[model samples]
Target: MMVVSTMTSPDTVLDFAHAVALGLSDRPRWLPSRFLYDERGSELFEQICELPEYYLTRAEAAILRRVAPVLRRKTGPVTLVELGSGSSVKTDLLLAAYAEEGASVRYVPVDVSASILRTAAERIEETFPSVNVSGLHGEFEQALPLLEDYGPVMLLFLGSSIGNFNQAESLAFWRRVAAALPRGGWVLLGVDLAKPAAVLEAAYNDAAGVTAAFTRNLFARMNRELGAGLDLAAIGHEARWNPEWQRIEIGARFHRRQTLHVEPLGRRFTIEPGELVMTEISRKYSLPNLTEYLRCFGLATAHTATDDQRRFAVLLLQKGE
Candidate 1:
């Protein structure tokens, strides 16, 4: 198992502190969702994936299972680079398909969490001895520029993670990705299609409460890492669909007035009752619009696959000359 450390622990901590301080000071208090994926948060998210109401994982996996072989044939021999690859459970389908085709592939799983990235790299190496695994430990932005050194590669941005970015951010992000990729490189993007508000709401607010636990884990992370004395019990999980934005906003709603003190920043933030501090946003998209959007970034759609119900889609895109 090979893991490359692109970011040092002190650098990561500083980045986190800056993001937290800036976000908390915003007019509408917010937190960078990326920080929610510490070791514990990652585990909670895996549990949330199994909830029946959370259909995203099942839908994307089904599509990948069906299309992986086709993708292998189309892309020829190329390394698989997955952004924000957590556990990489769904990625096994793609790796297995390549193996069956008698193709020796290299996989690069990039993530912010070191522990999860290391574990995933070891597991993949053990399970698929023929495939080489190189784990990159850092944010997507940090790893994107390094893709040029990897030669021919297929960038996998699965699980609708792009939804975390708003329009401007997404456009900027894809532009950077397109600039980073070698000509003719590929990107397999997973997106959740726009759906009814009720369905979107239920997906995030699962009956099993796993999703809630996963969101609430952010507080635990803040308290432990940032030295922020956050009262986890004082905030409740909230998920609501914003039709105007075509996104589901997940936030922590304070039950009562509370003050949080961060030892690292030596700062204090106060929250009033019912105040919602946005943690994440899952933006749904229309397939047609998304296809056009990618074109602006020099990414042309090569193939598209979706679940039977059209709840989710995994598009195979190529960076053009």
Candidate 2:
């Protein structure tokens, strides 16, 4: 089900290719979080949204619904552009605000999964025929330039996908996003606030084993795409919260010793009897920390709101006009 090819793009420069080759040159053989949403991964994540312990989606949606009116007022004509825009269901809540404002609206959803993008865009067209839905099939870091064509865009980096990047990576990403959008362009982001250790763990390590399956699917993807002999049963899902880092790390742990030979870039890594193949990290943030972080990158805070009891926040940050 996975297709393999050598496609070049802004993000796939030689360095990027070399980095990816070296990064995946590990025993368990890993796939990046961005690849986590390949059709199956996307569906699994959708299921994650409803899990009782996964309070993030519900909480962030609550905040957005409450603040989007005010957010729309400032970022009017709120040309909605969401990065990693899988399905675009949650986004409808905010898009409705733009529609209600009688503002001419355009919705651009960017993602790497062509299947997911095609299906999402089609469904969106059905629900809101007047809404212009464009699909960009690319990763966020590389896809920012594609956004130029749609600028004056109020970008959406929703659903705590921000967690996947580290602080330095985040700053670089924000800088790029800010540069793509001129002054007055808005970025509405959903961030998982720092919370108790147990709560964070439970959400990712769900009872139904959905998250686990989601993690293991990476191996399935690698084996299918890169000719890597990675056995899903040999790996287990691990999610842990790091307070100091204010983030959650998700990885696939190899239980029994097994070496995987990845053929994509001709590399291999020894599989220790038990080792974790780090795949994703989701960072939590506080209001002050996030505000200062974005400000350091030249983006100014336009508005901020949170769910009752501060479970999570959806912030509207803008490039200074």
Candidate 3:
């Protein structure tokens, strides 16, 4: 049985406006990275995963293919809950492993996009008819609490999406997940490890410019949904690697001083020439650093698998008894 739950809180629009207002008003303006995943933006991101310079997805998928059976065996029979399960493309490997392991597999994929979640859920049912599938259409923070109701679940945070959250935020999220899990529950975390600066930079600023389009689509989304008069041409995409932070920052730089009235907030803010409004941050981590991070949340790493290039890793973690 495939069940679909929709979460369209009335405050979502106001929530977006308030978040945008606060972020834009701050010194060194920023737009919440979550805002970058509007419909068109999601489609562009799917393209980005296929780019030659974007090796994170491919590397992580390779590792998952090798470790899927192992993870299935370790977790035994449990529901698989995935956050930000966009398309659930690479998830097939694990789903197959679970089914083959004779586990009573049930998949609960949570994502903010209703259409995407529905499509992915349908495809999953078609592919693994024996497995019960459900789609939770809501933000991770909103949908995660429901995991407790599902019982013995193996949580998945794939695609290196956790990189968007800084250390503090990531730890806080892990705490929430940790609280929801029962004893012996497991979490599969995907992370992109720090690499040469050049490799990191190229991944975000790909030569084919799909990544640029992905960033620019945020401006288009604001103009269309928020009624913001943003001139898309006046801003350009930029991706930079901060060696000190071991993170890649993706943002848009204002070409010139410009002011635009935002109908959503009934306000205008002058954007200075050369000013940058950061859109996303992809933080890379080392094994030791990640281990320490997991420990802070009272979780321990159970196993880790990486591709030959060592560019990405998938860590299987469990809460300490």
Candidate 4:
């Protein structure tokens, strides 16, 4: 009769509350990416992956497919931790490789959804019966300490999740992830590279409008969790790529605009016309940036894989020798 809650921390509620206040407080109210998945958001994202224009999912899968052999060679008792690992399709390759090599892997997936985590844990356990499939339902930033629970971890921040942070934020996050690990630890991250305007733009602003729905679901999530009376119908999704910052920005725009308060955190704000809450930032990286990033964190780059167009890159980092 152990009734364990799926979400591990109270920080998630705080993060969600804070994101809502920031997004709706001032004009041009925006929604945070953390609020995107409320069952509906996760389903929307899964659909997004199937869309013809959203190539990131399929492209990244191909790279992981090619590297299955190299990954299988890694030593056992490996701890595989994924940050923002919802709809983590590429993990199949890793788990299969682990079995073939007689390796027992530990999968630690951290996200901000109880329902998503509950379902994910069930599916992952079914797939990798031998491997210990534990999960932490919290933000990646806060889950650093939890990494200790999965010793000698090979941290994965795949699916262009790193792009969700700004350059400075990315560096700080990297340092935090590196510090959490003992020497000889390894990290594998997927990064979307700067590419042609049309290709990059199309990826985020898909024709089927799945990304838009995914963005708006943030408000729907708040309505459910915080008792905020949000009209999901009044919000729409928009994605913009800033060439200056080399990032993909997603946000929800209030339809007619209005003022709403999230009382749990005790904040009130006005939403403006066509303004964005700035949910996620997908920062495009070049090889130079990736190299400098790992070096600063005391990690040495061991190998890298790139897509056919070199439009995306996956780099593996090892603790300094």
Candidate 5:
């Protein structure tokens, strides 16, 4: 197992402070969703995945299990690089398929949490000794450039994480990914399809309350890391479907007036009652629309597989000449 640190500790702290300061200062405040995954937050998310209401993990995993062998045959021998790979539970299917083919597999799992990345890398190495596992600890922006060193890699951006970005951000992200891959390289992208608002809402607002805890954990993280001293008790979790955006917006709503002081950034923010601070957005996509969008970045859809309900899709895309 090879683990590389692309970002230093101080750099990570400064980045967090900057994001918090900027976000708190904005009107209709919002924080980058990526910041939500510290160690505890990551664990909470794993629990949320198992909830009956959260069909995304099950749907995407089913698609991967069914398609991994085909993907191995199509891509042949190449590195498997997964961005935002949490726990990497679903990735085992792809690795097993590649291993069965006697292919030399090199996996690069990129993520923000160093501890989780290391643990996942170690576990993969133990589970599949034939495969070489290298963990990249940093944001996608920092880790994508290093892909040039991996050679002929099939990038895996699973979990419909692309939905976190809006139109412009997603395009910019794909452009970077396109630049990172060599010609003929592959991409397996998981996407959650547009569904009924009620289903979408239920997925985020699970009856088990795990999803709510996951949202609240972000504020707890801010308080711990940045010394933000946020009133977690006053903050309530909210998940609502925006039909206009075709997305589920998750936010932290203040039930009463609260003041937060981020010691690291020397910034103070005041929140009024009922003020909702957007934490994340999960945008559901139409297959045709997403495929066309990828084409603009030189990624052509090669194959697509979805769950029986068509609630989710895993698109196998190849970089064009």
Candidate 6:
């Protein structure tokens, strides 16, 4: 069974305009990282994961492969609910593990992109004919609440996506997730660990320039969706590692001062020369910090697996029994 719920409410558009107006009005100018996943942006991100310098995807995949057997045992016969389940390429291992263990597995994948969600759902059903796949098309927060009705679900928030949120946001998100799960429910969280600054920076600003393309694609998205006139050539990608924040920051910097107009918002803005519009931040964390963060939300780490490089970690967290 395949199910998808798009934001039929007009509020989705209003929310976009409100966020854009608010963010662009702020000093330093910014856009939420969530806006970076339109169809083209999603495709670019898939390419980015394959880049030699982008180790996060591969490292997380390695950890998932190693831990899938354990996850199969822990999760038993339950639905696997995944948030931001893009491509879902790495998830093949987990699904395979459940099937091999003779678990009656049902898969629910949630994502904002209908095309991506549908494509992934089709692939999952076709490849693993025995497993049932249900695709939910919506934001994670909205989709999470629906999980409460399911039985013994295991949530998959992979790709270090939690790193997109700050400390407070992360806590609030996990609290909501914890509240949505039944007892013995699990959350498989993929997190990028704090490593050498050079390594982290390289992951975002890859030598192959795919990451750069991905960054610039945001402007293209704005132009396409918001009817914004943006000179793509004038916008360049810049990624820097902030030691104080312990995160890698990526932004679109203007080459020259210019005025931009968005038809949807009916607003115009000016960009100063060399000014940056912050696009995304990938926060790295330590095990102790993450453990405490999860603990605050009533989640305890049941098991953790890391790649041989130890550059990434996947934690199997469960609400207190």
Q: Give candidates' CA RMSD values in order.
A: 1.4, 3.9, 1.5, 2.7, 1.3, 1.6
lDDT (10s digit) by residue, model 1, range 183-271: 99999999999999999999999998887888888888778777877778898999999999999999999998888766677888888
Model 6 misplacement above 4 A: 7-13
In candidate 3, stretches whose alpha carbon ends up further than 4 angstroms from where it belongs are 8-11, 101-103
TM-score of 1: 0.97
Kindly indicate the candidate among 2 and 6 with the higher lDDT: 6
> What does candidate 4's lDDT look like per residue over 292-313, in tens digits?
8679889888888888878778
Query: What's the C-alpha lDDT at position 257 in model 6?
Result: 78
Screening candidate 2 with a backbone cut-off below 3 angstroms (N, C-alpha, C), the clashing residue pairs are 163-282, 163-283
Per-model TM-score on C-alpha atoms: 0.97, 0.91, 0.96, 0.89, 0.97, 0.95
lDDT of 6 at 171: 73
Pull out the clashing pairs in model 3: none
By lDDT, the candidates rank as 1, 5, 3, 6, 2, 4
Question: What is the per-residue lDDT of model 2 for residues 82-166, given as tens digits with 9 covering 90 to 100?
Answer: 8888878888887788877345578878887667778788877777656777777777766676566776778898898888887
Q: Which stretches of candidate 4 lie over 4 Å from their true place?
A: 1-8, 11-15, 23-31, 74-77
Report the C-alpha lDDT of model 3 over 1-321, residue by residue, as the tens digit. 789888666227667787778889998888888878777777888899999999999998999999998997787778999999998999998999998845568899988767677888999898887789888888887776787888888889999999999777787788887787776778899999999999999999999999999998988877776787888999899999998888999999999887755667787788988999999999999999889978887788999888998989999998777
Which pairs clash in model 4? 25-269, 27-272, 28-272, 28-275, 30-277, 163-282, 163-283
Query: Least accurate stretch of 10 residues (summed lDDT) in model 2?
Result: 1-10
As a whole number from 0 to 100, the lDDT of residue 45 in candidate 2 is 84
lDDT of each: 0.88, 0.77, 0.86, 0.74, 0.88, 0.84
The reply for model 5, stretches above 4 Å from the true place, is: 8-11
Clashing residue pairs, candidate 6?
A: none
1 against 3, candidate with superior lDDT: 1
Instruction: lDDT for model 3, please.
Output: 0.86
